[model samples]
Structure formats: structure tokens, C-alpha cells
Target: MNSQKCYALLIEKPKTFEESERYCETIGGTLVSFSSENEFKILKGRHSKKKFWIGLKQVNEDWEWMDTTAIVYSQWKERNVTRDVFKDQKCMFVSGTGDWHRENCEKKLYFLCKFNRMRLT
Candidate 1:
């Protein structure tokens, strides 16, 4: 039996980032935030071949977690960097290949939600 706790929820519907965040909140979770390689691996394993929104976005010229968590890990894909590009591409999503990409927030895409798992007594 699997005893590992899973607090992530993958919503495979297309929705804007803001809309997705609201949906997560309504379900008692927030947009999923990956803080380590293990967490990323777990998420990737669960949602293979699917691109989804994560809890990351650009804030004040720097990347920040929308859930206000510390930015401890990142897996951004190598690409040309430009101020104009970053300015327009504010939100982020994980690709099916497990790489991160900056995208416009208004772009509709699937999303993942995260919450604290309660231990069963």
C-alpha cells in the first residue's frame, strides 16, 4: 500500500491563471508550488504528458511564488532572455517535458492545486 501523502490536485481543464487560482481556493487548496526536486518529481510522475500551471509568476521584476512561499527551486528551460519578453510573459507553467516556461496569464491552460494533507489518526 502507498503510505506517501499526496496533497496535489491536477485540474485538466483550460482556464486562465487567475481563474485557476480561484478554483483552487474554492477547493481548499492553492496553486501547486514546487519547492524541491523531489516534489517536482512527484508532480511530474503524477501528471505525465500534461502541461499545467504552477504557483509561480513574475513580481517586481523577479520571479515569485503566488502562494508567497520562498523561491527555493527552479527548472526553467534555456531560452533567449529579453526584458520585453519577460514583461509580457508574466505567469509560468510546467511543460509536458517537465520544463518551466513563462507565459501570459490570460492564456488558458490546465492547472494543479496543492493543500496540506492531514494525518489520519
Candidate 2:
């Protein structure tokens, strides 16, 4: 496996969750997913003050990432109230304040793509 670090691209144009996912795939990546708090903080610092879709969505009764990683860490705006509010809003996004919120998957919004390119050893 390639040991190169994952990188991200912030797409300014707004798109629905599916649209954003397709766009990222065309460029050989997937929507961004947070694997750790430090990674999230680093990206949050660079992409602060902007709302962007992340690779998280509810599937059945559980939320998961586009990359198929198990959902671990989350930055929900209101952790206590999210479960009730997330009934209809299945997709997750990072708000301008770097807090996460759920919304309709069809709602248009900017998105971030995560990728790891191969490197010659």
C-alpha cells in the first residue's frame, strides 16, 4: 500500500451530495472523511469560515463515510440534539464555524474531496 498522506480539495461550487461524490470520483478521489481529531483540526484551520459537504451520510440507521471506513469521530453542532434532528437530514456538512451539521442530501453546497495519489518509492 502507498504510504502517502491523504490530501484534500475544497470545491467552491455548490452541489448536492450525489453530485459532489461523482465530481470527486471523476478526479480520482472521494468526499472528505475525518479519521482523527488532529486531521479534522488541520483541515478546519485551512478551510475555516466556509460551509462544505463531507463524506458522511446516514445509511439505513447508521452514518458512514463514502470511503467505507467505520464512523468513529464526529464534530456535530449539537451532539445532544442531533439524533432527533437527523431524522430527515441524512447528509453531513461542515459549517463556516467548523462545526458539523446534518441536512437534506439533495441540498446544494460546497464540498471537500479527499484523495491519496500513488507515489514511486
Candidate number with greatest lDDT: 2
Against the reference, the lDDT scores of all candidates come to: 0.81, 0.84
Stretch of 10 with least lDDT, candidate 1: 1-10
Return the TM-score for each candidate structure.
0.86, 0.87
Error of model 2, residue 58, in angstroms: 0.2
lDDT by residue (tens digit), candidate 2, 1-121: 1234566655667999999999999989999888788889888888788888999988888788999987778898866634765688989999999899889999999898888867769
Superposition error at 48 for model 2 (Å): 0.6
lDDT of each residue in 4-99, candidate 1, tens digit only? 324655565789999988998898888888778888887788888888899898877788888898988888884753468577888889999999
CA lDDT of 104 in candidate 2? 92
Error of 2 at 41 (Å): 0.5
Angstrom error of the Cα, residue 109, model 1: value is: 0.6
